[model samples]
Structure formats: structure tokens, C-alpha cells
Target: MTRPLRLHYAPDNASLCVRLALEELGLAYDSVLVDRRAKAQKSSAYLAMNPNGLIPVLEIPQGPMFETGAILLWLSDTYGGLMPAPDDPARAHAVQWLFWLANTLHPTARMLFYPDQYCDGDAEGLRRTTRQRLSHQLGLLEQASHADWIDADGASAQGCYLGPLLRWFALYGGATDWFALQRWPRLLAFAERAELQSAARKAASAEGLGPKPFSAPIHCHPPEGSAV
Candidate 1:
């Protein structure tokens, strides 16, 4: 029997990261979709699990894990094939990319995507700036995507975990025209494979998380070398 994991996530939020990981790992999981719009995450039930009331809390075989990065890491540690061995240098590379997504790229993209949180007035200007900044990161991601798994020529294994995040980036940054990523058929193919394997799709045909309107203030600033 497959041991099921419990994942608490908003239908639209940071929870997508963990959900994507679970899907990529091919693990059976029961997802509790917390409606952040209704403040369901702040309810007494969820609060008992995560005092911070964050989305993407994972209840693994070991215990509850809050925060998107932690949940992903836990899955990597607990499940084989999702991550490289702990002693492998590639494992460090995976962790580095994970943190880069969490601490830098994700936060930057959030700010650009949701300028309503930063300023009350006309957000169009902020959006343009954010888009420009996002483009630079996407460009970096495109170069990074040239690695083993993404590059059709290479036989190396890599995290296909960046798929959803890149999809979101393309959606927001208007970056579907990126030549580098487009040239990498392997990466696109990998994303499609992972998306098809997602639990949300199998269970209810849900598309996992979609882009939500954000109003949370960005706690982090745009990284240097960002076009914005």
C-alpha cells in the first residue's frame, strides 16, 4: 500500500512548489486546499498545524513541514528519485537552485507580479518594471536550463521541479518567446511529463495552482543584475 502524505495548500499560492514536488516524485497524497481568499489558513484547524498560517504545509511520514522550501526538501530527503544522494555534490546544486528559487527568484517575481502590495496607486508602471526584472532572471534561468536534463544532448539527471515555476514565469513575464528555453525541447518535454503526473490532475483534473492576485508586501528586494 502506498503511504499517503497530507499537504495543506491554498488553491493559489506558495503551496504549488511542494505540490509539484510530490507530483514529480509520484507519491500518493491527500491535499487540503486552503482558501486563502476566505482566510481558511488562519482558521483554528490549520493554525494548530502551522502557527504562521502559510500555505503548502506538508504532513510527511516523519511529521508536518511548513514553508514551501522545507516541504520540498523534506520530500527530497524522504523520497528517492526526487533528489540526488545527500553525499553527492549534485545534491548541493539542487539545494542551491531550490534556495535561489525560494529566497531570490520567487520573491522577486512576486513583487513584480503583485505591485498592489507595494503601492496603492496606479500599478501598471510597477508591473512593467517587475516584468523587466523578471525577464532578466528568466534569462538566467534559460541559461541554467541548458543543463543535462533540459539539454537534449546531455544525459545528466536534473530536477524537473523547476517546471511549474518556469511555466509561471513564462505566464507572468511574457517570456514564452524565449529562444533559449524554446530550443531546449528536453526541458519543455520534461515539464509536460511532470504536469501530466500531477496528483491534482489525476484526482480531480485540477490544474494544480493558478496565478492568483497577490497583495502581500515583498519582504525581499530584486536581486542585482536584474534588468529592473
Candidate 2:
């Protein structure tokens, strides 16, 4: 029998994106919660698989894979869904925008959620700056009509990634008073629809994300692990 994929995750972490991809692709996988309360991600075994000690390591036959974007892209390419195939003319736009999400938007979120990691002091001030940057980033996305991958009408690789991000904007790290999905009506619509899809429903159920996980955000209450 083929080995099933094993996903090491913490509820509502970056791993949530990967989990969604797996579900959307209808791939059978097993979940092994990484205890954030105990910093299990930094444990020797986890570190050996992912030197960065990040959550959501997907263990496959070849080895353990790290990085959510890389995994999502790989899954889309290998399994043939959630992305425009390599030969498709729109594939170029999709690939480029996917990179932008991975390299730009995702890092900006990291800064907002962990400003102290990038600053000397003044973490709150860093958040203020990051929030402005994040706002601009979202605005850019809101107007990105050329990005076919940003399709809101149906599931795509970018949709899977962006859904969790929109959720965090409303609920995670610190004060989310400055954030509102309404500002990006298109994205808000996407979020509302994405949450009702089969993959997201299963993911939300498994992670205790509650119904309407994206459009209406809430802190996760997992059965086995802490979200923080």
C-alpha cells in the first residue's frame, strides 16, 4: 500500500493552508498535532525534519517537506487541481502571484504577528507599520484583476492560502480593530464562500475553527493542541 501523507500541525497555524490543500485534493492524510504549548516544533526530531522548526511539516515517502507555499504548489502541480496546469496560458500569472503571496504577503503577516522578531524594541510600533504595509498589500490584491489565481468564485491554490490569512487579519496576534475584511469586498466575498466549501468545512471541523472560520473569525480551540 502507498504510504499516507502525515501532517504535523498546530491548530490555525500556517499548516492550516496545507491541510486545506490536502483536503481539496482529496488526498488521504494523517494528522499529528505539534504541541505549541510545549514548543514541540523546536524539538530535536521536528528540527531534524525542518531546520527552522516550523509547524506543518508534511511527511511523504521521500522525506518531510517544509514551507507551506512550496507544499501547496507541489500538491497543485502533482495532483492537478487548485492551480492552472503548466501548459495553460494563465499559468504564468498564477505562478508569479503565488510567489508574491509566499515571499511578500506571508512575510508581512509574520512581521505583524511577531513584530519583536524583526525589531529592536517598539513591537507595537512595528505592528502599526506592518499593518499599514499589510493594508497596502491587500489593496494591491483587491485590484489585481490580472491574477487569475486570485479567483474567488471557486477554490484555487491562492484561495486556500489566502483564506487563513484573512482569518488571522481579523483575530490573531494583537489588536485587529484596524483590520476588517469589508474593506476588500471581493476578498470578503471569497472568504465567505471559501468557508462553506467542503475542504474548508472539514478543516474547520478538525481544527475547531468554528463555522464561518474566515468571514467571521475566532480563536481556535483544538481538541489536542493550542493555537498559540
Name the candidate that leads on lDDT.
2
Cα lDDT tens digits, model 1, 17-115, are 566567667777887767665787789988888898766688876667786776777777777666567997767776776777777777777776667
Off by over 4 Å in 2: none
List pairs with backbone clashes in candidate 2.
Answer: none
lDDT: worst 10-residue window of model 1: 213-222
Candidate 2, position 7, lDDT: 96
Q: Note the Cα lDDT for every prediction shown.
A: 0.57, 0.89
- Residue pairs with clashing backbones, model 1: none
TM-score of each candidate structure, all chains considered together = 0.69, 0.97
Ten-residue region with minimum lDDT total, candidate 2: 145-154
Cα miss at 96, model 2 (Å)? 1.2
- Which runs of model 1 end up more than 4 angstroms from their true locations? 1-4, 120-122, 145-149, 152-161, 170-193, 196-204, 208-228
Tally clashing residue pairs in candidate 2: 0
Residue 157 in model 1: lDDT: 22
Clashes of each: 0, 0
